[model samples]
Target: MSIEIESEDVIRLILQFLKENQLEHTASVLEDETLVTLNTVESRDTFTKDIAQGRWDTVLKQVSHLKIPPRKLMDLYEQVIIELVEMKEHSAARTLLRQTEPMFLLKQHHPERYLRLEHLLSRSLFDPKDAYASGMTRDKRRQIIAQALGSEVAVAPPSRLMTLLEQCAQWQHQQGILSSDADFDVFQTTATVESKEDADALANEIYCTIKFPGKNAYAECSLFSPNGQYFVTGSVDGFIEVWNHSNGKLRKDLNYQAEDNLMAMDESVISLGFNSTSELLVSGSTDGKIAIWKTQSGFCQRRFSPAHSQGVTSVCFNRQGTEVLSGSYDKTVKIHGVRSGKSLKKFTGHASFVNTVLYVKDDTCVLSGGSDGTIKMWDVAEEACLYTINPAMNSSAALAVQSILSVPLITDQVLVCNKSNRLALMTMDGKVTKTFSHGKEKGADFISAAASPHGELIYAIAEDSAVYCFSVASGSLLGETKISDSELVGISSHPLSNIVACNDDQGHVYCISSK
Candidate 1:
């Protein structure tokens, strides 16, 4: 058993004694002389630093003070035990697993992991590393774990007080208290300023809008290029168009197929995705046809229809961009070679239409959500459904997952949006860690959702024509903006900016930017 003592507590106690002895000035002097900070280490940066340095003890010392969930707490203990095992201190590791309160609970909750640890105790030195290694280093693994745990720890944004003061000063100046136009420091007591910029960092109004109307031109899906250079939308009219992300200008010149802007496919485009470089885009169609287009030239690169009895609902490229993963209305997920134009693997299990699909867990697994109100994780090589998450079992009944967005930089998590009134951040193993609600009580169905470039925020467009922005770390609703008086749907976040793209049923796409 171990205990933590805050060193600052002793410093504070001395200061308190001084103040009680009626030596306020001396107490202030002593505070400055010692240069003891109250508790800045509770900040997310410090906690993450401790984790990165393999100081799991320091992190665990702060766990009770912070609001880390139980599962995350177990992760820290697991890290400690794994490290001890790696150091070849099997006795110490076994002691932790058997004697520690947290590990005792972990064994009861995660028997398989406990069993695996027991097996590791008997395996060779190199054997235990397999559970955590895959061309990844110790530092990188710690970094990933620290990042995942950092969100659960409460930390004020760096310089938050100063930023809020500046914003308040701006608001006061805009209200005519500070009248001078000359630039000056916001902290200055006597300076008067009139800056024409707003302090709100979230988009409140539409910045740029695009209107397109033709035969079956309703946009079914949209995606922003990973480079933040282009925003592309797939339409029911069988046409796909690329637009300048900043200006919303349609590039008709890129299409080499027809002078009249010939369609990308003969059937309705249902889903769209861009490769890591944004150079190539894949679109799935209602006729089960999949096509790849070169983004820069806007020319069709490859087209094929195979292995699906119905329309393709979603398509995404693996990290290598060499193969495509797709889900379809036929209630199946399939992988196809980008160059070979042949079906590579098929994962069949969903009892209803598959709504979304993506390769997760370093592309070793395929994760898909279906209209059957279930999310399934499949092993790519074995072609077996490893785990299934049912919405009803998770306390949200009658909800079908409409879409899934991968949380940026957080490898093991994804944002699952449902048709009912909730969206959740879930683990690849089917654990819902955080759930955000929409249209509460009366219930509003989310049409499409997207995460901010860094996955710090979530944006979901509901059938009510309003877009809701949420804080991913805190699971709080940040802001809500009505995009159209009509029906607004489909969301795609810019890869590099504070901009997000969404479209209405009338084929009118709107780009919203920071206010």
Candidate 2:
């Protein structure tokens, strides 16, 4: 049965117990702190006194006036009848048994017991000791009634706090979200609390600007190292530069040429990614080549030339950094081994250029988005297409997907942006949970979008040279800021901080941080 225990009732019970125990000083202090006053109820007191004094008529009248529960009234009637018989007041007990509803309820629910009580009325003078033979004392019976009344009137049981905690744990477990090692004590720690100062600092305005040189050789792509210590940018001039992200100082010119032999640079670097340890860097080029570089030496360790029939557009390392997945304009996605320099898998079926590709479903499957306006899931082990999603197939306007990014903190959803000036949060199975649009008037065609580290926000760069922020959960537009006067070509979020770096077509990079 559901029970609700009110705070006032609990305080009153404590005060009543304290007063009964003669702890006057402590009771007064508690009453002062809780602002509770002990007010006596004359009618309730009279009803109790009448029961103790064997005044059946008065007890019945008070119970009827108070509108007590039928069951409780029946219990009180049973107790009073037994008491009346024990006191040899048989006539009074018989009169009450005939007049009350409790007699009818007892007859209906407990006919044998009702018949035994009825037999008591027939006796001229029964032994008083016989009625008291049940071994239950009057004080114990009164205590039982009081306990039942307390439970019926309370808002919740005494163990409500523990019950709520258990429910929470069960819910988390059913959702397959709770860690096996987590316990109730985790809630009491400061680790669960978010730092408002750190949040404000991360949300602050653009604090640093990392400028790239060369007017025509703008950066095509930018990525922050997984450790967040370095930022790397791939330029249209075929040079990849790594910078100390915090200070904007050049740490290594990864594409610098030596005197004896020139570093391989057949075309502009379009995509770049760092492994989990930040020890290996991978870059895809327009010449259809994928190169793996040793980060410490800035030297190429493995190269997969003609990785695709057309230019490689996107590339990323899997969770272990042992495998690389890349998408190409040739309408195919390929996975390559980092050490073996061998193609592990190739997924085809995109009607148009594959714009982006990544490992999903615990690196067991690949998700790729194409310019053909379709996203496909491929089973890596089977080398077969599992599902294909066309986001704009129902619309009259053709929409080419520009970018697909994994939503941080959410495992099943990804952020998708298309040329239709629309952005959608979609599930791995191709279901659109929420769609965001600039409306037909704005004509804001998105170039790219990045998710915050916490996955609470998404930042999209549109053709208007403005960056728009949105809430990931509700798909609400949070705000917008103009990052450049010209079109922005690429945007990257810091892996470990609330820092966003965007590169413009004019070879300028702006670092934005939260305040």
Candidate 3:
């Protein structure tokens, strides 16, 4: 009986030891399955609370004193740290995870979000922790992008274009997420050019006028050049005239007069352009033909007959001057090679007669407007319709977009005319930064628009025979010139001058100086 009492007491002491060490439940459950009910939900909750509230620190310190493997302790720390981080208790969360170092898991699950968080943390380390400060940072970031990418380019269709814009928005969203402060600074910019120029100093201006010595009336002129030195003008007189605008001298005038040909209408020269080297003049006439004329000497180089059923309205030269694009009253635009003068491509998406086409730089993109009251972007390379410049919601849909002129005024911004007595300053991506409207004048129609060589001012001529100037940045009307009683259908600003030249509905032209 004495031996039995000693053995039972020893067992009791061991049981108490296990309980103090937090292994009592496990030991008891292992001894008899029926006793496992002691490790019930309520008991487990109490145990976990004790472990979570610093009681486990003492137990962990005691465990450190034991001969346990360092790896096992690290595993426990990782499990606990992951739980804390998942619960938004990041500080404590980081402490636990750092012990085990599960960085790969964090990076894999959240790349962009984690990047943003990292940015915020870095910012906070050097700055104050004001949440609103992030707003200002976000604005600054946007200003930087807007300043750098001042214009947006329209590449694909409306759907794809929307996707690109959304990416920009996403970038902006990330910036907002990464910013820690909102009240840092506001930036102010100054104009580079003076607001006024002395009248006497404006003598270096250019004065251009269209003169026709032909029998047929000079209905209209599409004036353009490869090099500014020599400009080519097309008129209703069935002629394309290349002039030395550099010194106000006539260079070469080539007439494509039909011999005794019965089918030839050759009504007039409606649109014209010069090849890159200024060696070939491409003209689209009232008759359905596109004619290429040699520049060095007046001669017919080649002729293309994708022939508009109606009148050809506009023609343009691609940046390389290898391709010629024409828009016609038959509601089609065609692309042809300069060397062969053969139709290489054609665009027929416009519902109404296509009026004007502008090739953008060396890219295959083209901007076209027509009587359909729509301005469309096309990729001549892909032969795709990218998108249409959405007409302003409040404006009349009935207002025809008779013409469109795109002047790359700034690096990424284009100045445009829509024939609605208004001008639009837009990004290549189709975002309108500003619009200038010529309020309703009884008989006025905004016909022509051109950007100054310096890109500081934009000049526009109205059918009411008035030429107006506006500040490109501020959109303020700077000046105006009233010249003729007939409507001014065309206008060109001198590359080196304050002088503006304009043509009227009657085919007469004038040169006026702002001075």
The superposed Cα distance between candidate 1 and the true structure at residue 491, in angstroms, equals: 0.8
Model 3 has an lDDT value of 0.56
* lDDT by residue for model 3 (389-458), tens: 7544257654556556555347665666655667887676778888776576456667768766566778
Error of 2 at 423 (Å): 1.6
Error of 3 at 361 (Å): 6.5
The segments of candidate 2 whose C-alpha lies over 4 angstroms from its true place after superposition are 1-193, 200-204, 252-264, 440-442
Candidate 1 regions with alpha-carbon error over 4 angstroms:
1-201, 252-263, 392-396
What TM-score should be assigned to candidate 2?
0.59
User: Where does model 3 exceed 4 Å of error?
Assistant: 1-216, 222-226, 243-265
Please, what is the TM-score per model? 0.59, 0.59, 0.54
Better of 1 and 3 by TM-score: 1
Q: Report lDDT (CA) for all predictions.
A: 0.76, 0.74, 0.56
- lDDT for model 1 comes to 0.76
lDDT of 1 by residue, 139-163 (tens): 7778877987887655444544455
